[model samples]
Target: MIRHLTNGISIVFISWIVGMIINAFLIKTKRYQEKLTNLNFIKSKKINKLIGIGLIKWTVKNTFFKFFNPKLRMNNKVEPNDLNILRNEMTLAEINHLIAFIAVAIFALSMVFKGKYLPAFIMMMLNTLMNLYPSLLQQENKRRIDKLKKVFTRNHVSVTATESLNIS
Candidate 1:
């Protein structure tokens, strides 16, 4: 019975790791890139270029989240439903990654307890990579936002000057 339980857990863990890796590949390749870019082509002036930039930035962040969600175990500050949608859409992948992560963690802890250094070192490296992927997306968003703010300010100034001249 104990052997069966360990085997089952191992299988679950392997499946999760495989699924997360697949999703990560898909997102990083930017398959949905053009779909969201089309949103910027709207005719309304109110929509503006800034909105498009914002949308693209958001899409990148969301794609990053969807890809490696299991390893990261992240949450959205603004919407709970978004997290649910992400998990649901990538169900098998998310499940496999999470289970694999838990299994690896347990294995690493066991090794550490026994003073087995090499396995623990490898597991820690993998864990660090999983954790860092999400932060890269977040930092990219901040950089994009700073660039957008400058553009927005420039556009605001030009529009204001044009309008003031017309009024005179």
Candidate 2:
């Protein structure tokens, strides 16, 4: 028990330091965002289907966890800029959560080697089903939103330009 306590505490301390470093690195760089957004994950289908898959989205949306929902209530097609900001925020959060998931999973795997098999298994399952899957889902949604924004903005701009030209 004492050994487990010491090891777990040390792991938590190290995880915190590593997480802080990853957070700093991620925040300082915006150049990689396009790359992140353009990833071809689950590309065979539309991003929405790739993400939610029926009851998962229904449950997640209905659950309305404040952490997941953020503040995306605008008429997205009308408020493209706000929608973009929200999407970007979700993307960043997904990246952060993914990093945390990796860190925790690694620690949990280490625990298994130390004979804490049940706890490690439980932690791994929790992170996989909760954190990792949610991050993937958020990334897919962001990708879809990015596509929608581009199409919406292009049509909005061209139509406006065309109307002004016709008036002139």
Best by TM-score: 2
Candidate 2 lDDT over residue span 21-124, tens digit each: 78668666665465654444455445546554433445566675433445533332344665567676666656665676789888898888899887676666
Residue 89 Cα positional deviation in candidate 1, in Å, after optimal superposition: 2.5
lDDT of 2: 0.58
User: What lDDT does the true structure give each of the candidates?
Assistant: 0.41, 0.58
Q: Residue 128's C-alpha lDDT in candidate 1?
A: 28
Worst 10 residues of 1 by lDDT: 159-168
- Per-residue alpha-carbon lDDT of candidate 1 for residues 1-168, written as tens digits (9 for 90 to 100): 455445544544464566467555544444434331112223442443333434433543467534544532333231334333433333333233444555566766787899966656566445423422222333333233334336446664322322221100
* Candidate 1 Cα outliers beyond 4 Å, as residue runs: 1-87, 128-168
Q: After superposition, how far is residue 127 of candidate 1 from its true place, in Å?
A: 3.5
Displacement of residue 41 (Cα, Å) in model 2 is 3.6
lDDT for 91 (candidate 2):
64
